[model samples]
Target: MVKQANKPTVWFNADEADILEAFSSAVTSTQLIQLIGPSSQLVIIDEAQQIPDIGKKLKLIYDNRPDIQVIATGSSAFDLQSQTAEPLTGRKKTFQLYPISFGETVKDTSRLEAKRLLDSRLIYGLYPEVLNNPGQEKEILIEIAQSYLYKDVLQLDSIRKPSHIEKLLKALAFQVGSEVSYHELAQTIGNIDTATVEKYLDLLEKAFVIFKLPAFNRNLRNEIKKGKKYYFYDNGIRNVLINNFTFPEMRQDKGALWENFLISERLKFNAYQSRFVNTYFWRTHDKAEIDYLEETDGILYAYEFKWKDQKVRFPASFLQSYPEHQTAVVTRQNFEGFLGA
Candidate 1:
């Protein structure tokens, strides 16, 4: 974006306590402008969430200086959004960036290479570092999952029992590709209430650890609408939680893993392309279900995931109710289009 704007760039690390304190302690926007000096076209702030009152500060700079554009980035949105929500309401545009997507990777590689890398990607995930450092993918993923992913959330005041956060993550990890019960999760975690479980899950999502897909329903009596299914933003992190990084062929939950991989990559594609859509999973009391459902522009697109060749039939009741929608089976044979690859 800096290069495209044809502007000289100035960068700052908000994570540095000295710089953040000094900059934020400035009395006014005029002082900030003087501190930044002249001829600065673009100002990029890394880990912007760490600095208190950063949103207001950025807004001050933005309102005062029309020539300079500001870009703020952080690992977690929980802090950043809370601080920026009201202050930068009209001044900012927020984006959620995940690991590399299939749509992006395919652009640089041939179809055959993409196919060959599918298993490795599904196992180790699409993190840029993991994708680039072939020999150290496991180490990198473990370090990220343990040390980097939850750093922002852990620092928040709302988190009292930090250890429970990891426990909740592990429970969610085990239940991937399946509907989650908050009550059941609370029971499993012992001494924690259902509300805390929910809060932790929300924090995890804001920290980019997991995302929930709510059940899709049309108010049908038998339609399951109360629960939600959670998936890790990265399979490598999920694997770290479960402590299993075996080859896909040796894993019994290959289908579930494949589903997680596809859904996450699909999400990344949707986000990067700015395809605004409401996503969900559909199921009925009688066990009829679709793995993924996406609604866009008042049109429903349903997908059932399969790691291998299998006969997948859409629920008859779903077809009868939503005849205007489209349904397709996604599998290894023809998943490229489904993933926008």
Candidate 2:
């Protein structure tokens, strides 16, 4: 729709200093308001996060333009969120754009083309550019993580030792689909405090690098435990960071990696479809556990992910108590249905 805009559009590449000077100077917003010509009612700030005091300036622009609109776009959410919450408080809607989901990439699983799509997803992990060019995906995501995620972190927080942050993220990449211990991370990363590790994790999550899935509970005894499991936003980045892209099809943990990717993608699917969801990996002290448990609107979907063609059976406890929740095995054949959704 933006490409189809009929009027002439001008993009202003205002830097960090430009925004600071504009905010702390003798000239008020009234002077800046005069410069906005008749055709330029809608001011689109590209990379608005770079500009400090942007929240205040945007509120000023918004109040002045009763007829016009402001569109702010950036790779990270920090810029718009920090400022808008205080000054532009009742205004602004938040939306996120994720990598092309597997459903979007596949039209029908029976088609021969879908196999190729699956292979690409395995190697490239669904970032849009990787979908277009499957070969250079590893390099592209590394560049995004380093150049974009890393650069944005520095601007938001003051960390005297940035090296520890990289190690913390790389540590997270290896521990996907498992509970993360911030204390252990602090101990390993040497000299960095525990709070710093957690702060960096929150920042990484905000930048779309990682997602932590919380434990589930049905108001039962000893449920909803502490230590949430973490998953990287992309499988390719996870594999590359841990130096474990060693032909998973031939590796021992192929089953675990595939299961993690499938569960995470399904969660993303539920969210994008506007369905409210509760998720978990169910386990008991005795070691019997389901790979993924998902509940929505009082209905449940219990899933077990496996690579082999073993016989499936239900747990006596779940069948007796939680029979209302649907149960299924997500194996090679039936897995397509979930991804093709």
Candidate 3:
């Protein structure tokens, strides 16, 4: 978008001293405008969450300067979202960029090439830098996990025990694709309470480290909705948290890993394509389950992820209940179509 725009653009890092100076009380809007000059038509601030009053600053720029379009980017939703919520309400649009999706990653590749890259992608994830670096995926993923992943969460004043957060994430890594219990999480991470466990999980979610898939429940007495399943935004980060990068054949949790990868990719695909849908996992007291479910436009879509191609049918209870719903098993052979790749 930036490259295609015909107007001159000015870029600013919110952490820079001069950018902060521009937002100071002493500097009038006119002075800041003069500093930017007339030709600068767009202003982009990266890591906008670093500035405490970024939303106010952006609101000022938006209200005062009609000619300059502003775009702000932040790594942590908790920081930038809260700071911008009231100030930019109805005045700004928001976009979230997740790790590169399968469609974007393989846009120009052949089916053979995509197949060749599948194993690596499943293990190391689709981070842009990881894709570009190729053979150094482990190093890149570890660096991202240790250095950049939790940086924003750690900076938040509410999170006092950073070590506990790390332990909490490691426990979550082991429980992907399964319902998580806050009480069990608290027990796993010593010195933390159930409330703290919930708070930390919320913090991790807002920071974009993880996302929860709530249970799909109708009014049926047997439907499950008491717990939620959490999945990482990136498979590589999850693997790094667990400190395991073994090949699929050598790993006992390959099925769970495949499920996580597919769900995460589908999420990115949906978000990027602006496909509005409510997502969840469906299970009943009798253990009849579907791995992923989507409700969109008054229609129910149920999907099961399989590492190998296999014929499967919808749960009998679900079919008896909602026979009009669509059901499909997404496997290695046809996942590209499922993810819109």
Per-candidate TM equals 0.95, 0.84, 0.94
- Where's the lowest-lDDT run of ten residues in candidate 1? 1-10
**Candidate 2 C-alpha lDDT tens digits along 1-341:** 13325554445444556643554451446754654444565666666665666777767767776655666667657655775678777766666777767676665343457555554565558777766775787788777667765677666666666687778877887676566788988888888888888888888787777777766655445444664777777777777666665655677767757776787678678768886777777655444556788787777788888776677776665656676788888876677677545
**Residues 1-341, model 3: lDDT tens digits:** 13436788877776778776655542456766775665678877787787767787777767889778888887767778899999999999888889888787677676678778887887898898998897899999988877766665788656677899889999999999889999999998888799988988887888888999999988567999775999999989999999898878788999889999999989988998889999999999899999999999878999999988998987888877876689999988899888988
Query: Each candidate: how many clashes?
Result: 0, 0, 0
Cα lDDT of candidate 2 equals 0.68
Between which residue pairs do clashes occur in model 1?
A: none
- Stretches of candidate 1 exceeding 4 Å from the true structure: 1-5
Model 2 bad stretches (over 4 Å): 1-10, 13-36, 107-111, 219-224, 308-310
Model 1 CA lDDT for position 48:
83
lDDT for model 3, please: 0.84
lDDT: which candidate is best? 1
Tell me the whole-model lDDT of each prediction, alpha carbons only: 0.85, 0.68, 0.84
Candidate 2 vs candidate 3: the TM-score winner is: 3
- Per-residue alpha-carbon lDDT of candidate 1 for residues 171-274, written as tens digits (9 for 90 to 100): 98888899999999999988899998888887777777889999999957899978699999999888988889898989999988999998998898888778
Candidate 2, residue 254: CA error in Å? 2.1
User: Which sections of candidate 3 miss by over 4 Å?
Assistant: 1-5, 25-27
C-alpha RMSD in Å of predicted model 2 compared with the true structure: 3.5
Model 1 earns a TM-score of 0.95
Error of 2 at 323 (Å): 3.5
lDDT-based ranking = 1, 3, 2
